[model samples]
Target: MSDTQFLAGPALRRLRRREGLTQAAMAARIGVSPSYLNLIERNQRPLTARLVVSLAEQFDFDPRSLRQDEAVGGVEGLRRRLSDERFADLGIDRDEIAEWLAAAPQAALAFARLYDAAGQGQAATPAAIDPMDLARREIERWRNHFADLDIAAEELAEELRLSNPDITAALTDRLRQKHQISVRILPVDVMPDALRRLDLHARQLQLSEMLDPASRAFNIAVQLALLEQRDAIAGIANGAQFSAGQQGGQGAQRAAWRLFRRHLAGYFAAAVLMPYGRFMRACEATGYDFTILQRRFNVGFEQLAHRLTTLQRVGQRGLPFFMARIDRAGQFSKRYAGASGTLMLETEATCPLWVAHAAFDHAGRICTQVVSLEETPGSPQRWFTIARTVEGSGGNGGGAADAARFVVVLGVEAGQGAALAAARGVDLSASGAVAIGMGCARCPQADCRQRSLPPRGKTLVFDERARGLTPFEFQR
Candidate 1:
């Protein structure tokens, strides 16, 4: 019935402490009981409008300062960060997070800083969150399709007489036969800042000696990928039909080219390391247990997941999955979807309720949820989602906090959800489907209590006479 809220408790307590007044004195000034003031100070009660007006009139405390400081103190950002599944087991609630954010904004922000520092990886920055940010949109655009590249890689492997596990040997032979380039592992110091570099004039490829066996092998495989799929990658890049502002210029063209090249190179590298046939069999046998596959191939979880998304070779297709990777802040650094709809997000996360954040809670554990998103008009996109939180090897002496942490989500569609039942150890779809929208600003669902803001087409009407539970009600 009232627009008044109890958000300013932290600020009020601070003011009382600063003024050296007891709760009784403060309550007398604000025309409230000492017991009620205790609840207000402890955030048990809200800073009422009447109390605020009385404080302004009696104690001369600025009402504007109380509102500004209180609003700024809420831990909405931290809540979003904690939604990462690594911290899922903590069982933190909104109230606790809000108290932390309000009582010590600096400490809360410092933790955020620590999180971002630790989560430094191939993450898309906040600038990429803007809908019209072309370079980022170009990058995300190229992320979806490795289907074409998968075919090309398979063809190249056949041409080079290659097979898996003995990838280094295959790479060496392929290099010599196809490109006449020799592979060498040079000292890390000699390689400068690069892990792998091509000395084309010398007709040689050099890999940094500092890399372990798996990484060293991957370097060669990536070079082979570049050599094998260069033409296809180039075609995809140049053929991408961007709009007038993003495409007509040489700079945008070059950016698009880089995006495709990187995507294809990664795809080809994964293909070479984990050949499609072998990888598919592994997935089928294990029911997509990534842990077993990761060890069998000696590849990272990210690599395993990326390879899975590329399992779209026409006759030999795996699940049509939507893979999204995000950093600690829940910003979508990379996202790829196969066969069906696309998740064109304005932010890395649409709501705190999304399991992308929950991945941080359980840390090393796998978390699954059955969610439905109405991205399309009539057809709702359902995902029996699987997510895992990945942590960087806390090697070196930098301590555990220095290790980068991120989450990877792989979502399989309707019929596909049943296939992962073996790996999940239960019926994933048994949870039924939790209804969701694309985003608060972009989504059309009007009745969602989880919406942080109203949809773009609607406006909040301010009524001086009445207040409802929600901030706004739509007319359209």
Candidate 2:
């Protein structure tokens, strides 16, 4: 279940070489023939769980380390390096690059470096990237749903609690009894990089002193999920591996594991805090009042929004919501859609009219509107969108007010907007849905007043005397 169908031929060969053993010797030790090992080395066969355990027992190798996607970071380096528009028609997607990394990591790293070197100054600036982005995109492609983890988390939520109460205590007790680990809060100066650290040798789990009470509780819940619900996460990940196919490379697999753990943790925490049955009733009764629900669960806006996206448990499902959070610069830091065919653009924002762009001006005020995508005018993808500014903890110097402002936008497709408290008085059937664009490069609107650049596929015409709202006139 732990993505055991990994094409670990490269890994196996590496291990054999590292141990200074020949194919026959290594194969004999692992209870396999040299010819069989040869097939694995060539990536023609997947390493079975039985063989993996045998190797671990014989060589004292950490199975986890062996299974980890080596040069996974290099895959990202390659992605960023190759994403330069210079190689726009490279004929290989990110998944193909991931496959190259898995099949041959050394070559992949070398290729990434070469690609980076070649793209000297091509105007297509590589965006600041999250290491987990590859996995995030892959998960989003699947609509952020992991049936196994969701089912298990829901069951665990019901078994663990009565209502939205005592989450930290419950998780702490679980850790203490199940994993023999005690939770402790430590200063940020002591543990800087991470909010939580597990000291397995000392049987202690450390939470950063910098985190708020709710965050501290969430950290505890996450650790509990990792310790208790590991198998569920692995099962979902294994399933993703086959479904992913080419994307299920070494680096991508590594990222997938992290995303699965993070997602499973979130699901578990949300389930515990907002019990499915109870939360469903509350959501309907309160008309999905976000702030009210946030108070009831003692979770942050981001957490509340994330939990709302996962309310797809068949009979007690809530509105199919799509939520995203971005910095003032319009970089999406977090994103999820409950259903497919999202109206939100995943790429850079070129449209100044999007409510998220306006959210920065009106801090703390929820801005809601029924808007349609500018790319497809009068398209049925019109969504009821609400955006607001959220301030993070300003730990560097000033107070919380000085912290970075992130805009959180939550939207539901046209028909479901009326049930939302934020959507009050919004006409779902209105023809006045404002058109939006993906970005300047992708937008085809010839009449955009604020257009910065012409669409990629169109030829821009320059006129000497005549001036229009757009600087460039396209040739159809």
Candidate 3:
């Protein structure tokens, strides 16, 4: 809407054909010339706002259908796909990819699918497929939003009349009255193996004493989702095409499907705890202050961070936030990109310069940074990132040293950073930003002191007489 052209030629052509209307007839109905309509259908011209309104009014269809779905990998996604080293010599530009998407989105999607298959080393057998990757792909396919589950959770939240001060009591009482499952908090020594366990035979929901109030409520919500929203979760999971030809074996497919369903149940649990409408209002009112929102919602840091990524409901959309959590060893435990389209989330190797990695050093405190990523020269993408360390559920017996730690990092586009209270007074300008990359291998940044590996596709330079700031010296 900000003067960005909407060129959905393929969609328009398909709509006209589906309606059995000739170009001239459609043009007349839309108050545009036949030639202009042809141009629009062929991707030579963008759809005017007036024409879109007229088409919607005359056709009685939603205007949202004219735009490409983010799930099919929009311009940013296609650009990332084209940046692969295999296509390095192609020298394809962003504008051409954008036009290609508008002209033939199905073909673009097909290309993306082929790219993904090739990345998987052309797995011929079902057993060769990685179930976890399949689950992650399903989540990314929908941008982490499950509309049906969201609505159901919102309704359930309202019926429960959830309040932050006694959310645990409310959930426990609901489980007890509705499902006849009583909640019991067991001592750590008694239930040392698991945090939360449901005994269907005993009609008891046992929770380890290790869990805090937030976690207790969360586990209860998860139980409720599995019991109440099982059908909805399964319906959503069934729609995911984990393999290209559904060739995966039953075991592999079941593993992927179960993982996907578990994540969906968690999504429903978060939605019930933090209903979309109320959460959106709180986010806007508090300027997205994580601390205040966490307290207000009675949720933990990770729960709040995960919920922030799913605020993509239509007409009440929140900022497109991408989240990632990593341990001290730089291993990513969780990652979700809710339409932010930042390419950094696509890879596991994270740059050490990122504040998320630095958050481990400054435990229990929030760290904010404005970083720039130049995937290509002369076009830098900026992001405002917030990172904070959370105590992992390693049990009290492990002590502080044995207890694991994780850094939850949330990021949004720098242009929207001003809306976040944490980014206030932080310079969002390009010059003030710390230039980071995907990782040492994929990064082309020269002379970075923290770089552990040479950049990919660069020739290593060896000189006995001198050494640079970084350990590896490579050709730029």
Candidate 4:
């Protein structure tokens, strides 16, 4: 494709505007220059491989977005184009071409334009659609389903603690004794045919066809419940609150309930493995150390952190706390809480200052940091928060079993330990309690270098004379 035909100039411009970045700001992020970026955006340049990766990381833009060609301008064909007959006589060395791609993007774009139009001015074929976007949507469906299952899981977790002490092992055993079935993973190609039995035997047991691994695990887990712990599982799901669609109609709500039920079964399994009272006692004894808990209980960090939030029940509640798990790039993997007052609706995605980022830095190191937050009086109700980062391993070989670094955070009212630790006199300054933005919009503290947008429910007052320590202006 010709350079002009494929270069997605409009979308690139829009993304820059949305991020509130000028060409110079973008250049600083990707280590380029204003004039160079300008030339590229104006269809005078083509993108390079290294720059493509840089753009993806810096702006958090999807890699697929740039590859759209018609949307962000593809530059992969630049090298071949530069090696064309038009350039052969020009004596442009490959080293010079590579250097221009990295150092002088403007010149590279100029070359791309000449080459793109040289051969019949045809445009390159558009890239395939992003699987991650679809994956994200699917993931969201699963998440909302889990959210709906929260109340049920909480109850089952509690019930299993009181009654069926070893749910996971017990369930695993039951499946073995009754059905004569062995657990095994089959490849995707054969999975659909391998588990071809969706046949239900009197509601006590059933098989599902063509289920994904996660979905299959859930179906089997649920069947295990019906076969062995029917009374308890039913009691939990039946008694838990169901919002409209969760009553089993078609849509996201019903999906959430099903996911929730499946998740509840797992929670029951975990609770069976590490009963609540026992786990809570271990936590207190170890000063909330994750590794010690993991070793003591034979559970993973993600499981341990998740179980921590579920430690709330009548007469058995631990200190009320919120829990979130984030990776090195600030991707939140899990969020859960039994706290009544804390707002825990995926808030981690909005707050980057929380120590979660630092957790991915150095593996196996626990960092205890303080956070300072303020409640808002605006329409949506917001908070300004400060957090600390701790690092850990993601297991080995970078697999699911790999030791993953994770961050845990709790909402501190005025007097919470983590909160007080961040107060002016509590002495957490050595722990790096720098102020940061919250959820993009809800953050109230201004003068923040991290401010992506004006704080919600507050007016933006630009101050040229006396800038607050943060970066933006704030009002009472």
Candidate 5:
């Protein structure tokens, strides 16, 4: 595979982008000029052994994996259209053509524009997506869960408050006593053999399944959490409800139920780990430092971020917050926060100022940032984002080709001001400032550098002579 013409420029670009790296940044990591790297991606030049080795050594990437070519959707079909005519006389090499297709994005765009003008119907388009759709879907998942358990969790919270600390520990002991189950770390090879099971006869509860060590540990932690904080978990879960009229379409009602139930369970889990009062106290103590929260709670970045949203539990509320989670390539897997109705999750996009993406720039590096979204309401809210490259379970040689690492971000609206200024006693607008839209479809911002598409619910007016920042003039 190493000696084969298997490298695809788009594949490489995707990999680099997923890692939140630019061509120049990647070149620096591998000791190559950005131009040389560009050529390699364009297929004008093949990657040398030195660069290949550097990728493996620096980022723990496999050389063999880099040799594999990933199909470039939309672009390939367009290229094949002119294949017969473009190089019929030259006898062009297939690899060379692929290189040209992958590396020359600008040329490809020009071709696509021309093709579109000619009514060729190119596959990919420039119109950006609305991320709110994605967020809404995720919120739906949580909403469904919470509906079922809302009342249950709330009732439990008050009742459990009296005995939470003791009950939590006792529950941990109960799982152990009932099943003789104990948490143990095992090598990766024997992880699948680690199962979560009960030995009814011998009264042994064991975990024997080949799981990713980190995930396995977290699951165990969550299980312990269930026992220790059931009451508090229930309290937070049931505290909030959108509206109860039993008056929606069947599909709408069902979706609502599902989301509520899911959110209930998630809230319960969070409560067990970080009780409402305790969490609020910690935030005050640490000034909302996400890393410190991650360490203190022994949870993943996304979990912590999601928990931040639920801080608004009745009188003990902290702030109105918005949370987002994205992978290295800025692909959003999970997103839930307040303001779901307004924001768009159309594309798996990342803010350039987001630090979660930067963490992937260097494996194990923790990057934090406080940036303002351009279109958000009021003053720019302060967001604390963290990123890192983590290995996934399973490996096909250099681990697993499917292993994916993601970046996680959590943010709070400026009830006071930007994160820093507020901390320093500067007054920041809390009410008017809200998260701006990611793209035009969900965003109402007039002139945004990141606007790739038009706002969804706006009237477009064409005035080429006096065009604003957006490609099209729009009415609010």
Candidate 6:
């Protein structure tokens, strides 16, 4: 077990209740006293490695369940919501918020939704909610892992014998044989609007000629998912608790549901391309070498990185990673927190000091950085981040091609950094780490030369007599 403390009282209580065992009965089964188990269940004491292993062995539960649950809602999300100017007078600390989250996660999630609604200046009606935000919330709710999809994809992968070298041919053959859909690669001039198009009348799946091998295979897998995994995807999407109060724009709600279903299909596609069991074993063997994994799996950097976040299978878990994709202007296009409790994705704009921004300077090269975030006073959260630029699917067309370049960043807790091949020999210490914040608008670092905006809820101090390193100086 890792040295990190597992203070998950709610998870333990939930597991105990699910198993229908009292505290004393659970304690006796796990060889611990009822008082000790009570302390663990109340977050007063951390679960030791022995207790975790014992519980897993006795109850057949995943040991990871002993950690704080990030699936329902994270403390970071609540912290970000509380950091708004509206809640400044409340003066709630991080510890207090964490305790509240651990005690009642559903209530905390409801509070976050209410805060979001207040920020939007309206109630969170189905019509009023942003489809993208709703999709993001659903993704975060499940921690980006769909067990049913994973299992189904894994079975499909084995049935298709995806271990072969020519995955595109295999997928193409599957479509041709099973679905009677002929796979055709059309030139860009022939199919100018979209990368992949299905001509239902002709029973054909047409893909753009511009697509690379990896992309071609992915598109085919996506089509396969649409054809086969519709039931599974629909079941999950329908299970989502989307807001229905004051619903007039049913179109927007349907769009949001479709968007979430599309995301699930894409997830299933990735899982089919990279089977969970094989991918997890390879990750451990390679220490998560992105280059090696990409080559072996025949996937793009973004695809490989995205697949890494979904390795949360019970009893066969891989490292919990958080990922974000951003453009040159620092706008977040995608964000996923697969149990990596980093607050980097809370905002659209991230810290200028992060290595992700610098990735644009050195295109196609993997840039690594260890950064420290002072989310709470005197207790900094450290993360090891990897950033690389990936060419967009849009065919190379002058400045338009340059505009399509996006930087994909993958991050893990600094303690887990040593296990990654990318972070080997790099300094993971606090002194050597770059200091960044959630974003410039929320960051409190006053001395940073790259600071673009002053911290929230602070009085600005324009000192002409003695200028500071940053242009925006605020009263600390």
| TM-score of every candidate | 0.59, 0.67, 0.85, 0.47, 0.46, 0.81
Off by over 4 Å in 2: 1-133, 162-164, 242-249, 374-380, 391-402
Per-residue lDDT of model 1, residues 1-476, tens digit only: 35586566767887888889999998887778999999887777777777776776776566776644222223444554554434434657667776687566556755754543333221334322232233333444443446677666666556545353365687787787789999888874687567778999989998776555667667788887777677877777676543223213445446555765677687788886787887889888987877789788777767777777767676887887778787767677667654433442434455556777788887777787777775434345667777888654322223366556788878777557777743355444535777776556655566667777776655556788986566666654
Candidate 5 yields a Cα-based lDDT of: 0.50
Measured with C-alpha atoms, the lDDT of residue 92 in candidate 2 is 56
lDDT scores of the candidates, listed in order: 0.65, 0.68, 0.83, 0.47, 0.50, 0.82
Give the lowest summed-lDDT range of ten residues in model 4: 125-134
**For model 2, what is the C-alpha lDDT against the true structure?**
0.68
| Pairs that collide, model 2 | 374-436
Candidates 1 and 5: which is better by TM-score?
1
Q: How many residue pairs clash in model 1?
A: 21
Q: Model 2 residue 73 lDDT?
A: 36
**Model 5 segments beyond 4 Å from truth?**
1-172, 178-218, 221-263, 339-359, 362-402, 415-437, 440-476
> Positional deviation of 39 in candidate 2, in angstroms?
44
Off by over 4 Å in 1: 1-152, 155-164, 169-194, 199-214, 244-248, 344-349, 377-379, 391-403, 421-431, 444-450, 461-476
Q: What is the lDDT of candidate 3?
A: 0.83
If candidate 1 were superposed on the true structure by all CA atoms, what would the RMSD be?
22.8
Report the lDDT tens digits of candidate 6 across residue range 289-385. Answer: 9999999889999999898888888899889999989998999888888777665687667888899999999988999999998755446799999
**Residue 177 lDDT in model 5?**
62
- Order the candidates by lDDT, highest first — what do you get? 3, 6, 2, 1, 5, 4
**Stretches of candidate 3 exceeding 4 Å from the true structure:** 1-37, 45-71, 83-93, 120-128, 162-165, 244-250, 397-399, 462-465
Q: C-alpha displacement of 346 in model 4, angstroms?
A: 5.9
Model 2, span 122-141: residue lDDT tens: 22223322335545644654
Return the lDDT, model 2, position 282.
Answer: 88
Residue-level lDDT tens digits of model 3 in 5-84: 67788889989998999999999998999999999988789987877878888896777778664545578768767766
